[model samples]
Target: PPEPPTGVPPLDPVDPRYIGPFRLVGRLGAGGMGVVYAGLDDRDRRVAVKCVHRVLATDTDFRERFTREVKLVRRVRAACVPDFFGADTGAEVPWLATEYVPGPTLADFVRTRGPLSGQALAEFAHGVAEALTAIHAAGVVHRDLKPGNVILAPDGPKVLDFGIARATDGTALTRTGGLVGTPGWISPEQYRGAPATDRSDVFAWAGLVVHAATGRGPFGSGTSDVVVSRVLSEPPSLLGVPVHLHAVLHRALSKAPEARPTAAQLQQAVAGLPGTERHADAGSPNRTWAAVSVPLTDPREWIRGAPRKRSWARRHRTALTAVSGVLALALVVGLGVRALTGEDSSLPGEPSGPGGTTGGSAATGGTTSAAGAPDDAPEEYRDLYETGEVVVEPASQDEPVLVRRLEPSSDGGEPLDQLRIDFSEAVSGEFVDFRMTIDLEYLPDHGSLTVHSNEFLGLRAITPGQENLDFRTVGNTGLLAELTPDDPTETVRLTFSGGVAAVYFVPLETRARAQESLDYPGGFCVPRSMSGVSETREVETFPGRDYIGPLDTTLTNGAPLDNCAYTEDSEYQ
Candidate 1:
């Protein structure tokens, strides 16, 4: 058998034979907490189990954090992270295991393969950006995003080590004045004792991108205080990075989090670098992905360079959780959440054996199609998944439906613009009975959205031969007609068919003057495919310009009704 990316280290005599239910075969790595061992289940499925030290296992705070880590992974359903199997946090040793992703860390990859440049570096940037996008999309911030935490598997880069990741609901595991994260990669806000938000992760992303391109981090390695000082004051060391990436890295490394572009935006920008191979124009055929074929069992991927463990969990092994009651309460409400699509769980026809990185660029409109769809197929979200519920409008020669929304007030006010979609081209056909998903970047706290058409704002239901067909959603158990300020509501997913093509947001309670800004939801239109396999093509941050009222005339000839063209909601105040 070929040696893997994370080589199996021989077990120490003191290591336990089993952590939880799996029988330990060998050790992968060790940290202050405990040993990470290669294990096997009764069926002999391989797993990487991290068993915590007994002394800390009994600690309530550590145990709770470990449980929270499990919860975090459970909620995150992204391909850029390791596949999660199971964890027994309550076990005496408290070990957590995941589908052991086989690949060298970014640190190891660049070190061995030499610094990545050209297309490979750009692809790496896109992969890590997608990983961060997935992490932030799940309401978590990866506080430590150095090269070590990034694994270069067969299927692009996977972001691991959620030990320091904090939920966006303000549920920080760290105490004020106390710090977390590695030195060089830590964001300026983190050094100043500000909270770790999505932008903080972006800053670290900038550092990691720089680090991956060149051997050293953007700030170079140093003692905590020295690195923190430079990170707060000095510009990033982007001398060796490609010139095209300079602008993005500069923006991402901005001292002020407000100035940073989002990971999704970064994915959009970096993937379009000059060296990246161009594809078909939008609405054109030839949807290809950027995939690498490093197998899980490849000896090159599994070669252990060194143990690189850096997270709050790894460093502060015995640290107590000073998480406030309010934060804890918020986390309880936000635990185990699926994003806008509600389809974070595994996708259909996942390529087994080797790393399952497929063909296509992350910048390409949507998610990568697994199988069944030939290259000549339509770019739809339905065909990508083997099983999942969605509603896709059939391809029609007539006018196509388009939806748009004005971003909420930058100051957190009411619905300043219109939310509308022209459903005049609503399709009715047996072949169109496919599932579709509309993913928004940010789902607001309250959902007062009302779907309307040229005729009415909301429709009752679609009647296909008097069957009363309704779009089925797996997660949105209740179609919330009303939401409060404390509501954990984030994603706005529409399960309706041709009539309600899109949703409009009207915040009922965005009260008080805003000292901080809110993230606008992401938009991506998944076209219907004959097969259930589809890709997640990202759309604009908001539909269009901030709070544009609406378009005066109707769109024509299959032209997209840009969000700016959408008229204001007449039913809304």
Candidate 2:
């Protein structure tokens, strides 16, 4: 099995094989709501398939929200957003497919390549603002817009993952009682438990730009509690952020959501920035990927431009003439009408036009009716007007799930290098699972192993045992395990010696759900919806290979556990 693209990892035993007509080739990434896989359509075009976690899909409310949001997400058509292909919300394991963007995430790019600056930073700001404009125009609010959700594609920055997004009409999709967005990137209103709107996304957009300009978030890094407090009380530190963008970002990060500019206004302001001339030129297809060399000027000055100072006489001349004409007409009508009608002045109710009496049209300011005639026509031809707004019934919020504890330990048996994690909340089930991927190509000296859980783990629950697992070496590979728990995704990344040679999953005491089926004789079971067989079944037969086997419950006691082991050696020690 050949390695997939850069950020994409090999599909694990637990992953689905086929989602609808697309063949799942590799794992793009996973999150709380679902797992994203890289798949190929019948036309062989690559797409990203996002499948909701079984735990969440089982909830009727969640499925309804997923179904509704998918409709709204499809309405978003923007260059900065991934193109939506299709979805099956009613499937056993509901999944939606989108265009696969072959680019590193904004978080990964900033971590590996360093913070963006100059023209690259300008374009990034403009592109993200453009994405917000498209999303808001379609009546969808991107509840989560962190660095991880943004992909720095070759064409521009693409905003991905509308998994938590809801319509702008105050439709509550955060049924899970916990806060909807990531810690530092979340806006003040969201922290205060207010419903998220397009303005909330604008606030997030400012924080994202700040993170891109500087390597860190606007609120700074700390535990979730500390970060949340700072976001609520303190002003964002825009220190390393370019001076030109200070005013807009400061206003955008205002404590009051109403103070923030609308997405369209934000786009206009970003488009007016000094080095964003290329962005303003719509006809130019060849965009500059590299940083543009331009002097930093006051963004406010550019955005406002030069004010046209008009003389007082020139401004008031038109207004004075219009007022005089109206007064003269009123006086003449008053005198002539009385003389024509002989004091009563009330006209008979007679048909005044070819269609009918012109009274209705006069009352309606001479507006045309729905029948292509004046509103003065018969009442039967009058048109009933509506605001054209979609009324989405609000959803009730669900109780929040709190983590009682998170325990990490080594599997002291065969394949001693494997690590096992147990959550108090029963995170590993038929629908809920975890993902682990190793990357040894990018960094030469050492490799990295990243493990992500679909469940949310509190910082306090996992911090104490973090040091206990640091000394454990990964099998005979001699790689030390260092746990770096990511708050947003509940992920842990461990640095190891050299690169990853082989990855193996030991059989756990968990059984496949009724909706899943086994892929191979000894391979792990996958979703029944993805039970479609591929045309070719290739197998690897060597050491130092990326081998992810199925969790065979037949060989072990039914204890409901799973573990991952990595070793450079050909055979298990």
Candidate 3:
């Protein structure tokens, strides 16, 4: 027949040549349930055929549950769902066939291309919601609605693999005392041993969208126990998610199943979003997804272009804990909490160090200046550096640090606003670098600051009861800071309806050194000879501002510096 699709591995020696009326051409993938093969029907139409493993095929309970779910899956008719063809439940090795969708999984897409944004992100969310609407309407709950199950085709996104799905009224066939879903994507109620429902799928959908937008699950990455614990207690970190869609997703991820919106309501909310009109208007009539007849490109070509560096098993090992009833037992004994917090026993809102400064060095705690600035700071910009917090010594080169909190503050004067960032551990002066750039062309002025650290790990917001802060600078400047942490370098974009005239760098320690000198020789309000330095310059539009940067300097242990500040001006150029 047509040459097997590239990236489709050749069938193994023990593989069957045929399953019912379809000819197995190549192996697509294998999972806990069975092996999926690329096959062709008598008419030569390509299909994805999933055959139940022999071990599972011998289990009468599994066979009965599979048959029931198969009937429910057949009832699902949606444009965003692959067309189900047929199945043979009575075969020696039961198999089901569906349309062969040639595309990368959403997990692969996001990992390779970075997180989706703007219209693309909106379309992806809307399409998946539409799929859920159709599935739920058919009385089925896709217990596992994760990034791996969504395929990103050129036409649109398609939800795949209903292998773990079941009818709303159907009895689950999970092994006794075992949980039935992926850890990070599974709902809290599911972990609590509740039956999977439509609302549970909604919780998973929100998590999938979060993963698509942030390149990480809502609960963050870790061992299964850690992720499960975070899902049960810690709030999701939506730092990189678009601000507008946060509310709906947050509501959808509510711990209470009754509190979450239904699939239909979720579809409507997603379709009604501000920038999703194009996708919304293109919605299929009768709420059914039309199969795209367009020929797919050779998978080999694209697969080579963006190689999947991590195998499915390797990537999900930590999240694939086959949770047993003992999970509740472990939680009861505080194992979950201990695992969640790791060796660092500090909890949210706990005192990080001396002086209330989150990352202050307890060993050499010192008082602040009269103006609230660190006592060792330069006299010229002391007020600008003051934050009413105790100052600590500079961190050593190997100490790991992270941005633990971000908030707005005043510099005790006019025209300048500050967005203070606190670290989980004291920042290593010798290994940290800061660079800020501003762009004034957009209606709401925007710019970015890069915080690069050799010892930087990731973000960890420790403010109790507040996982995320409202985007606001002093005077309600409407200043929003969106942090995208990519390990070693975290970029924070500042968007506001005002102008930024200058940017300053202040290390909290009394003794810090510079890895390199500042770029702007005369831009500093305070002498460069001092640890703390500032850059004053005119603001310019897009291309013009592209070349202008506040400064780029790496701090080392030497002179005292404390934090960074951005001063706004009405007459900024």
Best by lDDT: 3
Quote model 3's TM-score: 0.49
Candidate 3 C-alpha error for residue 537, in Å:
86
- Per-model TM-score, in order, reads 0.48, 0.49, 0.49
Q: How accurate is candidate 3 locally (lDDT)?
A: 0.51
Tens digit per residue, CA lDDT, model 1, 108-132: 8777776776766776787788778
Error of 2 at 95 (Å): 0.6
Off by over 4 Å in 2: 1-7, 167-177, 279-286, 290-573
- 1-573, model 3: which lDDT tens digit per residue? 334456677787798766655667678889766799887654455678898778777777777878777766765667788877667676778887887787788887777767777767887888899999988877778888888899876567889876444421232335542566678999999888788889999999999989988899889998999999999998888889999899999999898999999989988998888657653455532212223222355644322332122221122222222222233223223312221111224223322322123232321112344454435534543544343221111122111111111111222332112122322211111212222322111111111122211111111111111212111111111112222212223323221112222222222121011111121111111111212233332322212223222221211111101112122222111
Q: What is the lDDT of residue 321 in candidate 1?
A: 26
Q: Rate the local accuracy (lDDT) of all candidates.
A: 0.47, 0.50, 0.51
Deviation of model 1 at 281, angstroms:
17
lDDT of 1: 0.47
Across residues 100-130, which tens digit of lDDT does each residue of candidate 2 receive?
7766778988998899888788888988999
